[model samples]
Target: MIVVTTPTGQIGSQLVHRLLDQDKEVRVIVRDASRLEDTVRERVETVEGSHDEPGVLDEALPGAEALFWLVPPSRQAPSVREYYLGFARVGAAAVARHGVGHVVGVSSAGHGWPTPAGVLSAAFAMDAELGASGAAYRALSMPFYMENLLGQLDAIRGPGAFHLTCAGDLPLASIATRDIAGVAADLLTDLSWTGQRNLPVFGPDRLTPDGMAEVISQELGRPVTYRRMSMDDYASLLRSRGAGDQQVKDMTEAFAAQDHGIYDADWATAEPTSTDFRTWCREVLRPAADA
Candidate 1:
């Protein structure tokens, strides 16, 4: 049996489907089993509860061959590091107890980055805790998620533009969540590999925000632009949208780390994944924009 966490999320949903396609025996830990598609719910064993809870994993992990782990975000947490590490610590203990053979985790790409990266730094810490587990671990490291643009869909439709705190000219490495899910599914199914390592899942494109705007305009057949917001203004916007002080601070620091080239070194050396920005814009963004 293979266990998946956050099975209803964008990445996890896709990974679950891919595993099913391969005829893998799958089990998922979710807050609401009803949220899963009827077909998916009928096919997989369901353990209804938050994966961060010890009891949930204790119920789901026994006899499981491999596990796909992802820490769902918590904006209300007092500290970002503690929030991520809390989930990781629970997962690590469960892995050791269950004697699960392999573990695949979702993580960011700034492993040796010199500066603190807020949420990204927290994810790296989670990796450390999980790696220490006796199970063989693969940290699926990635850069910016292109799906983040979906959050600004309203701005894209209203003002024909997208906004970010990072510099418009600096090259940004990004990957589609579907690609990340694909990589995870492949790793989880093939448990022959051993030991702990970071596998970088980067897309083929290296487009700056300005270049991204140009592609969006061409793909959507509308004049879209890139707007660089000040870090202070971004924090104010997050506050206005109900983000807590800790969340606001962590997000600001993450963006600052991005602007400081946290993902630059890794992206420069890694093999790019199948999806490119233009293809993702045409396939994912264009349909969302039209809707």
Candidate 2:
């Protein structure tokens, strides 16, 4: 049996469906089982609990062959690292205690880089904790999530314009959550060999935010413009969205780092996914915009 945490999240939800499609016996750990739809809740054994609680894991972890573990983000935490580390420490203990052999963890790009990754520091910590756990682990290093762009859909549909903080045609290696899920499903189904592994999954092509706007424009059959927001504007928008000073600073630093090619590192292997920005816009974003 494979147990998955955060099964209601974008990547985790897709992973669950892919596993169920392949007839893999799966268990999902969700804080509230009622949050899941009727069909998904029915198909899998639901361990209605949070990962932070050891008692919950004690009941859920045992007898699982492989586990897909992820620490979901929370705004209420003092810091993302503190929130994530608490869960990671407990999860590592659970993995060792339960004897679940293989573990696949969702990590961000540039996990082991020496320099500070700002917002991505939590993922680096996850890689370290998961590495030391002695469980067979594969850290999937995902790029900028395509879903992140969904936030701009309102502007795209209303004013038909998108604004970004990035400058100078920054190359983006974005990946769809569905692609990540498919890969995770493959890993759980085929656990051939693993000690500590990393997969760099990229989309079919890389494009700048302006280039992305053009692609979306073409796909939507409408005129769309892209403008770069100043640092001040960016910070103001972030603050409006409920980000404090530290969160705003972290986001700004990560964007600067991405521009400087800090996050562009070699992975053990590259799994190029099929979903390009144009196709994603056509199939997913466009419909959402029209709605």
Candidate 3:
């Protein structure tokens, strides 16, 4: 049996369907089953409640071979660091108790970089918590998601511009959550690997906020521009949108870290994913815009 956490999230929900397609016995830990698709609800075993709770995981991990874990964000979290580590510590103990062997988790790039900011730091800390356990782990390391742009579609429609905290011209590594989930599903089903590692799920090409605006203009056939906001200004903007103090701090620091240097080295991998910026803007963003 394979267990999934945050099963209703953007990545986990898709991963659940992919695993079902492969004929694996799938179980999910979720807060609300109703958020799941009608088809998904009928197929998988549901353990209702938060996955980070010890009681919930104790029940979910027994007889399970592999696990897909993700720590869902909460604006109301008291401490982002403690929140990430707290879930990891609980899950690690449960993994040991239940004898689950393999773990494929969601994380980001820059694992070894110094003083990683915000979610970047918390993600690395979470990986360490999972690694301390006996299970073999693979952290699916990602960069900025392409889907982040969808949140700004309204701003683009209204003012012909969208904002980011990073510099307009500096290249930003990015990947689509679909590609991350696709590779993760392949790994979870096999369960043949042992030992811990990181998969750099960077997409086909690196593009800056300005470069992305160019692609959006070309794809949507409308003039759009990139608006670079300072870290303080961005934090203020997030607070205005209802983000709490911890969330504002985490997000602002994460963006500042990216502007400095998101990844430590160049990724010269062979045959990276083909879902380039233009393709995403054309396929995903265009449909969202029309809606």
Candidate 4:
């Protein structure tokens, strides 16, 4: 059996379907089993509880060959590091206890950077804790997600623009979540690969926010632009949207790290993954913008 966490999320949902397509025996730990589609619910074994809960993974991990792990975002946590490490520690203990053979985890790019990177730092800590578990591990180290633009669908549709704290003219590496799912599915299914390593998943194009806007305009057939917001203004916006103070602060630090090139190390050396920005914009964003 293979176990998946956050099975209803964008990446997890896609990963689950891909695993099913391969005829893999799958089980998922989810908060609400009802949120899964009727067809999906009928197919997989369901462990209905948060993965971080005391006994949830204990119930799900036994006899599983491999596990796909993702820490769901939590905005209410007091400290970002503690919040992420809490989940990782639980997952590590479960993996060690059950003797699961392989584990694949969702993580960010800045694993060994010298500076403190807030949420990115938290993810690095997660990788460390999980690596200590006896299971063979693969940490999918990802850069910026292109799907993050979906959060600004309203801005793109209404004012024909998107906003971010990064420099509009500086190119940054990014990947579609679907591609990340594809990579994870491949790793989880093929348990032959052993030991711990970071797999950098990046899209073919390194596009600036302005360049992205140009592609979005071409795909959507509307004039869209990129607007750079100050870090202070970004924090204010997050706070206005009801994000906790520490969450806002951590996010701000993450963006600051990005601005300082936290993703540059892996991006410079890694082979590009399957999806490109233009294709993602045409296939994913265009449809969302139209809707």
Model 4 ranges off by over 4 Å: none
**Model 4 TM-score, all chains together:** 0.98
> After TM-score superposition, what is the CA distance of residue 41 in candidate 4 from its true location, in Å?
0.9
Count clashing residue pairs in model 2. Answer: 0
Best by lDDT: 1
TM-score list, all predictions? 0.98, 0.94, 0.95, 0.98
TM-score of 1: 0.98
Pitting candidate 2 against candidate 3, the one with the higher lDDT is 3
State how far residue 96 of model 4 sits from its true place (Å).
Answer: 0.3
Choose 1 or 2, whichever is better by TM-score: 1
Candidate 4 lDDT, 1-291, residue by residue in tens: 999999999999999999999989999999999999898999999999998875998899989999999999977887999999999999999899999989999999977999888899999999999999999999999999999999999999999999988999999889999999999988988789999998898999978999999999998998999999999899898889888888887898999999999999999887899899999999999898888
Winner on TM-score between 2 and 4 is 4
Ranking by lDDT: 1, 4, 3, 2
Q: Which residue pairs of candidate 3 clash?
A: none
Q: Tell me the tens digit of each residue's lDDT in model 1 across 11-81.
A: 99999999999999999999999899999999999999988889999999999999999999876887899
After superposition, the stretches of candidate 3 with alpha carbons farther than 4 Å from their true spots are 242-246, 266-271
Worst 10 residues of 4 by lDDT: 241-250
Whole-model lDDT per candidate: 0.93, 0.81, 0.86, 0.92
Clashes of each: 0, 0, 0, 0
Q: How big is the RMSD of model 3?
A: 1.6
Quality of model 1 by C-alpha lDDT: 0.93
- Model 4 CA RMSD to the hidden true structure, in angstroms: 0.9
